[model samples]
Each structure stands twice: as structure tokens, then as C-alpha cells.
Target: MLAIPAVPDVPDVPDGARPRWSVMIPVHDCAGYLALALPEVLAQLGDRDDAEVVVVDDASTDDPGAVVARLGQGRVQYRPNPGHLGAIGTFNRCLTLAQGELVHLLHGDDTVLPGFYPATEAALADPAAVAAVCRVRDVDADGGPLHTTRSYRHGTGVWCDALESLALSNRVRAPGVVVRRSAYEAVGGFRTDLPHAADWDMWTRLAAHGPVVFVDEVLACYRRHAASDTSTRVRSGANVRERVTVVGVVLGYLPPARRAPLARRAYAYAAVFAARTALQQVRAGRLPGAARQLREALRCLALIPRGLPRPP
Candidate 1:
């Protein structure tokens, strides 16, 4: 088994020194994007003492530290991991290092739009909700617009049925959501096991604790490039298997009475989507990959009738 590297010493927060918000950017080798993203993030902070920005460099071979020093200009607190910690490990490290009422785990490649802070903060003002999410706009590697995903319901309010919506699909992009630190500590950090679905898993678990507020406007941009972890996994067909596993995990977190019906709905949806992907693969002349995906689609369809779910 591959082991995750140990986290080095993170700067300690003085006793009773808590900020209103901690915007944590975890970067591996996305310095180009970081240069663009940092300015936007810092703009949102606007020299506010109650907000802090922390950038975690996971021992990248690239000069992310130099980038931070140059663009961040002594404003962003920079921490470099002693060794390599993968995305999940780095996320856990961010949770450990964050000392704020709310934590925004923004990736180095993603950017938040103006009004993200005020809108999300207002939504989370409800004491009953543990987290808040806004709509996400998908952008290309060059920051050109691709498409926008309206992950939440069509209004600006707290959604009590967040788990049900999340069970269907992950509506919260990492950059678009801000979670209360207390809720993160209670549910634990992102699961290392579900690499592709870690964010989805975290959303489902957090939703279980309390309601989730949704902002109707697009508040963040998610970059889809070839080098991104999601793209790499999808190309290798790992995401297909991980998607099945994520659905099962979400099912386990739901009430037992609601599990069976939701499983049927979820697997049925997966089967249809997989079949479409298989057809696309075949059209692209990847015969073996298409056959494998066809088999997965059939397997998902078979499970729908039995109402029996299994983890990958």
C-alpha cells in the first residue's frame, strides 16, 4: 500500500485567536493558476483582520513558494509540506492548520468570484446549518468559460433536504462551499479512501449534521484541465469505479428506510450514464474500454432489481 507523507509543523494559532474565516489554498504544481487565483482570493479578503489566507504547498518541485512570495506579497501565510501529501492528506492538513469559524478549502487552480464571501457567509448565518454552497462555473485551463452548474435548488436559502440532493449528485464544488470548522472537526476530514469522491463524501457527511444553505448565484469557478485530478482519474476509468463506491457510501449514511429506494434511483441513473459513456468510447474506437464500461453499466443495471448495493 502506498503511504501518505507526514504533515510538517503548521504555524500554531495563539490561544483564543480565532478568525472569522480561513481561506486555505492547497497547491501541488499549479503555480500559473495560483498567480491568477491568489489575487481574486485576496480581493475577497479585502484587508480584513478577521479573515486570513493560508496557502499549503505539498512539496511541489515547482516554485510555488516563489509565486506566493511574489504575488501574495507577504499577505498570504505560506506553509510547505516537508514531504509529499496527496490531495486528501493536504486537505486534512488544511483542516488542522485552519483556525477560523468557517473554512474555505479552495484549490490553487480554482477562483472565487466577487460577492462569494458575503453571500455564503450570510447563508451560513443560520445556526441550524453547518455549511453553505454556491453555484459553480466551469472554466477551461486558460480561464475561459465552459459551462455553469447549478448544483443547488433555484433559490437562496437553506435546504433541509441537502442529503437527498447530494445523494443524487455532488452539488457543492470545493471552492464554492464554506464549512464551519466545528462541523469539519465533528465529522472528521475528507476520507482518504474515496479519492475521486472525497469532496462528495465530505458534503454528505456534513449535511448529516445539519442543514446546508445554498446561494443561487455562481460564486466560484472550477477549472477543468487535462492535468486536474478529476480528468486524470476519468481518463483511467478509475472515476467510474469510484463513482459506484461513492454512491454506496452515501447510501450507508442515509436512513435505512430511505436507503433502498434511493439506491435503486441512484444505480439506475449510473447505469444509464455509464451506457452513454460506453457508446461514446466505442465511437472513439476504444473497443476494450467500451466493453469494460458496457459491463459496468450492465452490472449497475443488475443491482437495481435486487436493491442490493456493494462498495467498490
Candidate 2:
């Protein structure tokens, strides 16, 4: 079994000297897209050798490992995992390998916009700021604009706004943001349990610890392809159920004083999601899935008329 060195809690080098940004890409059979993505990432670096790009290949069936290796750029380092552990594991592994003060969890298939590095660096310059999230545009496989954008406000405090945001919707998409390594570790990073929404989970935790600077400018183009996990979830029509699961877990993490209101809101969102899921399944002629969603929606709706309660 191949074992790469664990990501150190703190790089041997001091923060005063470590790279300003650590661009981390977690890959699984994304070779076809990496070639297009890597150069764009490099271009965004803007002559900053203090930034490093660590690409962790998660045992891809395609030769992505070799592709990343051939990039031959000293700023970019490549590592292959022992086996396939899916996206969450790949993300965590890449986090472990990062050496910079900031780690941007850029997916292998996503392309960084022209101003990504500069915008992110400016956000992290403030000592109190723990993260910087830029606008993200959803693009088709051919890189055409899909007219969908993930946008949010400059949130106050650490992970608090993140928690509240997830309670609302997945506003801070993974590729849309960059994280301070110290703050990221303070929150203990991504939750392996929520594989489908791990990025949302991490963002919630991250936002609780410090302030997240919202770059109003679009700094990334997130590819919406069938092969991508995001699209797969949408196509499977499991988005509603997956979101419900995420909300439940996030509600559990809130304080007792906030849980009740949050839970009520989460349930309401779940009801809407359930109804949507039921509709999608019915349209697809999947009676079993539709029936299951109908039950879930009914259960949520039944709780609504009872009035929203304060947190326990």
C-alpha cells in the first residue's frame, strides 16, 4: 500500500514564510479536464511562487495521476491515494497535504477565473478574516455559461453565518471559496459523514469560526457535467433527500438555544424538497421513489401548521 505523509497540523515553516495560498485539487478520473483546468489555475497564480497547488489523485481509472505528474511545474505537486475513497476522502487527503497558510479546495474539473488568486489574497490579508468566497458561475461541459450563479453576502463571525447559510441553501459552493488553514483545522475540516454535501458541511463549520469575505466578482467557473458528482446527484433526483439529511445533521450541530427555530425552518425546507422530489420521481415514472417522497413531504407539512417553536 502506498502511503503519503499526513498533512501536518502546521507546516514546519512559520506562517510568516509559508506560501500565501495552497491550491488543493482532489481528483478522481478527471484527467480529461485537468489539462484544461491546471493551466488556468497556474495563470491565476500571478507570479506568486509563495502559492502551491497540490493535486491529490484518488486512484482514478484514467491516467490522471500521470497527467498531473507531467505538468512538470515545481509549484504544483501531485500525489495518488492508495485506493478510491470518493470525493470526501480525496478532499480530506488533499487538506492534509497542503503546505500553505490558505487552502483552496478547487475540484479537478473546475476552472479558476482570471482574478481568483488576487481576489483571494486580498480577502485573507485581514488578520481576522478566516475565509474568502467569490462568486461562482455554473458552466456547461463545453464551458458555456449556464446562467446559474452561487452568490452570497459578506458574512460576519466565523462559521456562524455558514451554519445559517446552509440552513438557507448551499450558497457557498466548494470551488467558490478559499479557506484559511488554521481556521479550517480549528473547525476540524470536512465531515466525512455527509459525502454528498461535504463542502456545505465544511462551509458551515468554517463560517462558525471566523468571518468569510465575499468577493462580489466571479472568480470561478464550476463545470456542470454529467460526470461531475454535483450533476449526478441532480440527475438521480436525490438532491432533496440529500439536502434534508444535511439540514438534519446541521441542525444537530446548532446550540440548544437556536435548534428549535432552525429545526422548524429546516423541516419547512425539507417539506418543499420532498414535494419537489415527489414531482420529479413521478415525472420519471418511478412510483416507489415518488411514494417515499410523498410520505416525507406529508410528514413535514403536518408539522408546519403546529407553529414554529423556539429553540430548545
TM-score of 1: 0.89
Write model 2 residue lDDT over 14-74, tens digit each, in one string.
5467887888888887787888888888877736768888888888888876776676366
TM-score of 2: 0.82
Q: Report the C-alpha lDDT of model 1 over 1-312, residue by residue, as the tens digit.
A: 212223333356686677889999999999888888898877878488888899999988788888888888577999998799888888989988888888999999999999999899999887678998899999988889977976456789987689987886676688999998888877877888776788988898888888888889998999988788875554456656777788888877888898888888888877876777678668768677677777788878887886755764
- Which pairs clash (backbone N, Cα, C closer than 3 Å) in model 1? none
Which portions of model 1 miss their true places by more than 4 Å?
Answer: 1-16, 275-295
User: What C-alpha lDDT values do all the predictions have?
Assistant: 0.82, 0.72
Query: In lDDT terms, which candidate is top?
Result: 1
RMSD of 2: 4.9
- What range of 10 consecutive residues in model 2 has the weakest lDDT sum? 1-10
Candidate 2 C-alpha error for residue 185, in Å: 1.5
